[model samples]
Target: MTAFVLVSGPFTGGEVWREVAARLEESGAEVYPATLTGLGERREAGGPDTGLETHIEDVVRLIDGVEGTELVIVGHDYGIHPVLGAADRRPERIARIVYLDAGLPQDGDAAVQLVPDEEVRRRLLDPADRDGGTGWIDPPAADGWQRWGSTAGLSEEALARLTGLASPQPSATFTQPLRLSGALATVPTSGIFCTESGMSIAKLEGLMTLGMPQFKALADPRVSFFDLDTGHWPMLSRPDELAELLLGAAAGEGHRLAAAPAQELPGYLRPFVLDVPEQTRERIGRVDLYLPADPDGAGAAGANPADAAGANPVDAAGANLAGAAGAAGAADTAAAPRPAVLFVHGGPVPETVRPTPRDWTTYVGYGRYAASQGVIGATLDHRLHSLADYPLAAADVAEAVELLRADPRVDGDRIALWFFSGGGPLSADWLSAPPSWLRCLAVTYPILAPLPGWQGVDSRFRPVDALAGAGRLPVVLTRVGLEVTEIAATVEEFVAAAEARGTDLQVIDVPHGHHGFDTVDPTDESRAAVEQAVRSVLGHL
Candidate 1:
């Protein structure tokens, strides 16, 4: 059975979580609201002697007494310190930690040290702990509820509820440093950002963009992020929303929000959205660029490849006909242009410009993988639905190719195009008349030939017919064995034509794999095969 342990912030008690607890209990969950020593009912029992360690011990005892196998530990405000300490001590007992408007503490980091605002520390924290003082920190003034983020829309009821139950915090909880055995990192963590407070997704992303070390953990992809439009005390102002978010976190769907994966990009990778000019302003095709940072982590190198005038277009054009090894050797330079791969995603719709979460994750994952292997990964969206027919779809690919070739970080002479599923037939022109700079063409379970229903469109959509003009452009084709016979026949026809025309093509058959194996199965075998496929393309590049 799964149990939840909710810990309240400084100068607050577990009573603050009364409403949220009630909702979770209604869901048949075993919930425990922990009141640390020197706070809530225990205020009179604690004095100067009550330190951070005592608070940690308080939660540790509660966890030990709980009658459950898995635990979802929740911490709010200053309560995060003791909760993290307890989690480090008992990692296996924890299923996940849902932090509510709280700053995370590292192994040797103190609670006070985690606060980014110096004014808050100097005004509230310092005065309370000075010269071995009463070891108690006073609560914020009632008039400053907005600054404290305790009230959502400045409701008198919410403010009265907050100040009514507020108590003095133990000074030791702020001064004492937390110690971790590195077990905390292994545990799955989540966060609920009170957007009405000072912590917005944009602010967090800004910190990540600046590469600030203090905010590193918040940038982790594994830690799901959520936003509540209320103040810091959502339980008091918006209990239903808070309860639903907590329940979602428990169900492991907290990462469903759009802001969840915004910070998933690594520090070494610079991501930007490129708008395709030919499309409508509202529905223009967009391409995402993930350029790898240089070795020294300064920024992206080879971003100004267009500035290098040494590249000869004629030489690259001639290299297309020269066989794989010859073409690869011809483009070699002392300061070679960075290799780039254009990613085209597949979907049921003919033209898909904005990919879904599954598609985005898969593309970004492949992009990062390509960057790790010393190549640029670019994901492009094409006009879908009404304007997604044969010739128009092919035009979208051409525009994306032109954009990649024009990028400063890309070697205009060393580019590869990867098509997935429905996108296979649209790139027939590239396969038919292979370009000198087009190093490799890779497709995974693609619709190589037009289907019977789509024959009303132009004949140029037929990829197998274009194989005669493919010349010697190196190709990597991944076929899923479990695919339907129609698609299988298309793959077979493309392969046979490529062989007959003497086009340099490599075929990889995943007999036990289904379509979108990487996204669906994600097994070790699938991962290894994808890596091998990428390596094969890179080898030809």
Candidate 2:
């Protein structure tokens, strides 16, 4: 018979897993629900000194008392710390380790490091707020339970029971680093993701495609995934389902995510929809300048035939602008410097992505389409390769702008900056102080604010805060209705701030579109929205 050891998250403890444990026991499995040192029934026995080591010892003692060899250890949220530490020490006696809606922590990771909210983390780190010198962290208020994790599917009665049983967590439990001997590296593992809490197997797979080193280990063949439709506390909201899933997890049966396929061009790098005439591409530093075709119509001066033939347009807006520019006298158009749009691609993209963002089809298509419109189009590769590289990335963008303006073909004073994805925050620097030459600023599906737990991000990169200082700079924003919740919240915050300040802002809504809609959702609505936004931006220029 398989033996199951259940571990609870923060605050409430072994009592919280009673329902799930009962179901497991009824199914003929031996179940042990562990309450760590400062929580649940053990709350009175703990004091300020109870920490991660104390908790790990608590779990180790329970494991030592078990009379069987087939053991499955499950940990949820903060409970994973002790579970992992104990499992590492007793690897030979364990069958499998199940991560029950928890983060995958490594050696030396403290529970405090996993707290996502900056303000809450600050309070936890503050010695003055340590429960009046008791060195205990208070449980969240009943009304603020959602801050810990989504309380979806929990009835009023269940919530009240949870709140009433909560106990203050010892400060040392969060601050003490977990130690691991790395003995359980090859142990079978299963991850239970709570979809409603913003984590899903699909999202993890997408993140893995970015080539982030930390996520690569998840692709191990011994690991599997199971997603629950409810929120974080599945033991409370869906005990029956959680119990059955745990059984299957112990048997090493669950969805196995396929390794990310190797491809020449990933989905994000695919060609855009709208088709248009291409132009010459000039490489200067990290920037790629796409100039309009030569006046004599022999095609662009230095254009690569292969790339030009493959170039596609991103939106119909460029065609309209091109027609308007064509109506003017050729001689006059040829003699004058052209207005420019500097396209900034977004990401804390892993430095491992080949060809970089500038070479991606979306930016290339947009650049070529702008050139087709008789305007100078430019794209550049910046150093936004990590969350902590924002300042360096911002500096790279500033330098790129200067280089674009210095080109004689570009009308320096009439340039606009078009930002995308994570690149949206870079606009904060320009918006905080609108330069005389900046005709317009455009952003699409942007991240206007720092995401939760994004450490080392400079505070200056908040576009929502910068709006108050933006004078009359015309801003065009393209937003998607199906955006990720965290990113969508940032966009809403930006819109609210823009409205409050009466900033010259135009919002183009793509009601059914997703982030990177121009490339991903190639629907008519996405195309039209992109066209409208580009036109508004061109009008400002």
Return the TM-score for each candidate structure: 0.47, 0.63
Q: Across residues 213-237, which tens digit of lDDT does each residue of candidate 1 receive?
A: 3355554556777778877788788
Per-residue lDDT of 391-421 in model 2, one digit per residue for the tens?
A: 7789888877877666555678999999998
lDDT of 1 at 116: 28
lDDT of 1 at 257: 22
For candidate 2, the TM-score is 0.63
After best superposition, candidate 1 residue 29: deviation in angstroms? 0.8
